[model samples]
Target: GYILSYNGGNIVNAKTGEKLFAQFLPDEVIPILYRYAKEKNHALLGYAGNEIITEMPDDQYVKEESRINKMNIRKVENLFEALEPHPTKLLMTGDPADMLKAENELSEILGDRMDIFRSAPFFLELVPKGIDKAKSLLRLLSKINLTPADMIAFGDGYNDLSMLKLAGMGVAMQNAAPEVRAEADYITLSNEEDGIAAALEHFCKRIFKSKRLKFRMWFKYGLKAQKLLAQGI
Candidate 1:
């Protein structure tokens, strides 16, 4: 098993702690992000390797986020200096209104060097271009001798859009964003109602009843299924 963290900026072996892949922000972009955060008074969090670095340690929003995510908060006086040359991802959180503004401005400021998007209403994420869940999953699948067609993906967030589309079976929860549901192959119950379990059961039953012997055989052997629950953090 493997874990794709920071929206696939980093992939690691779930059992052995071995790094399968990692993509960090370019050295040039770190200063840009830091300058933007400082000038805008936005709370910024940097994911550098395994550490979470931030400048606003006492900011209420940052404190709440750390508590909720159980993140070890490393408060730095200067994030750009702390992270320097190798930060994997950056997350900016604040009022949704401010986030929207930041998203728009950063999109133009960073241009094509990075991908900037709102993972949540109040949270904006920045990662290197070409790094996303689907792309990293493809890399992992190739190493394991499997294809996207062999996988089942589930998601509900905007960031999950690509992964949902790339999988052979894309299941969206009832509570998913409208865009997500529209792109899914099937819609299941909401997460609170055990949506993932419901979708798996329905597919398993259908596979058993249908004439698709290939899928049945694969299931009987060992289905190479991939499940992604986007936290939208």
Candidate 2:
């Protein structure tokens, strides 16, 4: 299973892609967003974060969406109705002022009931309050009776900080921002250099005290340096 929206949303069964739970834009916050969209000011733009709606191409899509708003800011005549029943999450624009606008206007409206934060550089997410990746991972661990010590989390972004901190072994990518790197237990190679594979190799070597296990498997597959080993004699 994997956490989305920094753990506010989740895919419970990874292989089959099952959704166990989700959070949405609260009712009180919607109207404020509606006013913001309708006013067409402060660049506070957004879209109805449902999957099907989001997949619709810009041209084929009926609603007028914004190119400036990186979220695609789907324009809807009836904002509430357009959001519909399955609008699990809301992806807001990344503009600093746009983010600030929501905070200033809906901070009190949302209060403790909602979560509004900048989990990434490109988008601001809205999820249920107290919902985060670490919390969900903990719940999943509880069911399996596995503690954080059994987990090895990998991350490369701001949203990953929580999980990285909570994991038994958190490995951050070389490309990760400085803050994310700080939260990691160890910094690995960059994503482009196969950081995950590299980290796993190191972890496994530490476990077995040698790379022999991997070499044995390689030998069985007829992909080994057998000549070099034999030359040692």
Candidate 3:
């Protein structure tokens, strides 16, 4: 089994805890991010390995993130130094309006080199280009000789749009964003109502019935072909 995290920026073996694939922000971009954080007075958190590193120990955003993720927040004098070498992703936290503005500015600044998007109203994430759930899932599928047609994806956020589109059947929760719901093949109950389980149960039954019908049709056509061949037609 594999776990795809950081919006597919990192893929790891579930049991062994070994990374099968990973992407990182460019080394030069770190300083630019830090400078922007300072200029905008936003708290930036660097995600490297299992740690969340930041310079603002007392920032409300940082504290809230620590509590939400249930991970220890490491404070350092210099975020750049603490995240030496590279980081998998960066999170900029501030007011929703400020983050929205930052997203547009960073998109122009980074161009095609990086992917900048919002995971929440006040959380903007910066990651390497082409790092998303669909792309990463494709890579993993190729390793096992599978394809997107074999996948059934479920999602609720904007970030999940690509993955939902790429799968054979895309399921959106009732609470999913409007855009997400529009793109999904099916919509199920909200997360609070065991949406995933409900979808699996519904789709699984239909899949089995469809497979049985296809098999019967194949058998019918196959017998006709065999009879024609036997009769020298």
In order of appearance, the predictions have TM-scores of 0.77, 0.65, 0.78
Over 1-233, each residue of candidate 1 has an lDDT whose tens digit, in order, gives 88888888988999999999998887788778878888899999875544567988877777766774678788887787777467678888889899999999999988689889976677788898888899999999999999999999988778889999999999998988899999999999997799999999999999777757776777765433322224332
State the C-alpha lDDT per candidate. 0.84, 0.63, 0.87
Off by over 4 Å in 3: 56-70, 205-233
Q: What's the lDDT of the predicted structure labeled candidate 3?
A: 0.87
Best-performing candidate as measured by TM-score: 3
lDDT of 1 at 107: 90
Weakest 10 consecutive residues of candidate 3 by summed lDDT: 79-88
| Candidate 2 per-residue C-alpha lDDT over 31-139 given as tens digits, one digit per residue, 9 for 90 to 100 | 6655654464322333444322332244321232233233443444454566666344554543556666666565566757777665545445566677777887887
The TM-score, computed over Cα atoms with residue i paired to residue i, of candidate 3 is 0.78
lDDT against true structure, model 2: 0.63
The better-scoring model by TM-score among 1 and 2 is: 1
List candidate 1 stretches off by more than 4 Å. 48-51, 57-74, 208-233
